[model samples]
Target: MNAYLILDLSINNFESFREYIEKIPLFIKKHGGRYIVQGVEPEVMEGDWCPERVVILEFPSKENAKEFLGDTEAQPLFSIRHKSTTSKLILAEGCS
Candidate 1:
């Protein structure tokens, strides 16, 4: 089964986030992950759920997604993200 990382973020510091963005792609690619959606304005059909930014990443499997999240190479960049934005991130497995 495939896996996805879904992110809803509100950026506090664009400059710091830019640095994180610049460094994340290589790690994503290395871990068999690709962006499905990035920083797009979302349509809210129902309740009061609106986000400043949304990111969706697809990985080969749940394990791969976990590996990407835990990657040592991405640690510093991950820290940057924490400082740059307030985010809610979730990992979900796709139906096989």
Candidate 2:
């Protein structure tokens, strides 16, 4: 089954976050993952929860997604994301 990583991020510093935006995709690609949706403001549908930026990534499998999450080389970029934005992320498997 394919897996997806969905992210809801609120950026605090775009200047600092730029590095993560530019570099993290390379890490994702290394792990057989690709961006399905890059950062974009979401439209609120039924809830009061508002998201500043949203990103969705697709991978061949859940394991691939996990590996990407745990990739050692991406740690620095992850740090940049942590420092620049408050983020909520979830990984879900698609129907087989």
Candidate 3:
């Protein structure tokens, strides 16, 4: 089964976040993950949920998603993301 990592982000510091944007793809590819949806502002079809920017990534499995999220070498990049944006993230497994 595949897994997805979905992010809702409000970027406060674009300059810093840009660094994360530039660098994260390498890690994602390394972990067998690919972007399903990159940076996009979603159109709300339901009650009161408007995200500034949304990202969705797909991985081969839950383990791949977990490894991407927990990479030690990516800690600095994660910090950059954390400091530059108010973000929410979730991992969901696709139905088999």
Candidate 4:
């Protein structure tokens, strides 16, 4: 089954964050993951979860998702994110 990494991020430093954001797509591609959604304008029809930003990434499988997240080449970009935003992330398996 496919897996997804869903992120709800609140950015604090826009300029610094931009640099890191730019690097993510290539990293995902390198790991054979695809972007299902990235920072689309949110619609607040009704909910307490007014997430500032949302990203959903689809990977071939849960193992692929874990490997992508644990990649050493991608580790440094985290500091840029850490310095720029607070984020909530979850990994879940897709229904087969």
Relative to the true structure, how large is the alpha-carbon lDDT of every model?
A: 0.94, 0.95, 0.96, 0.88
Model 4, residue 64: C-alpha shift (Å): 1.0
- Candidate 1 residue lDDT tens string, 1-96: 999999999999998899988889999999999999988878888999998789999999999999999999899999999999999999999999
Per-residue lDDT over 1-96 for candidate 3, one digit per residue giving the tens place of the 0 to 100 score: 999999999999999899999999999999999999998999999999889999999999999999999999998999999999999999999999
| Model 1 ranges with Cα > 4 A deviation | none
| The best candidate in terms of lDDT | 3
Q: Between which residue pairs do clashes occur in model 1?
A: none
- TM-scores for all candidates? 0.97, 0.96, 0.98, 0.91
**Which ten-residue region of model 1 has the weakest summed lDDT?**
38-47
**Candidate 2: where is the Cα deviation over 4 Å?**
none
Error of 3 at 36 (Å): 0.4
By TM-score rank, best first, the candidates go 3, 1, 2, 4
Report the lDDT tens digits of candidate 4 across residue range 2-95: 9999988899999999988889788888878999998775777897888888989999899988988888888888778887899988999999
Count of clashes in candidate 1: 0
User: How much is 59 displaced in model 4, in angstroms?
Assistant: 0.4
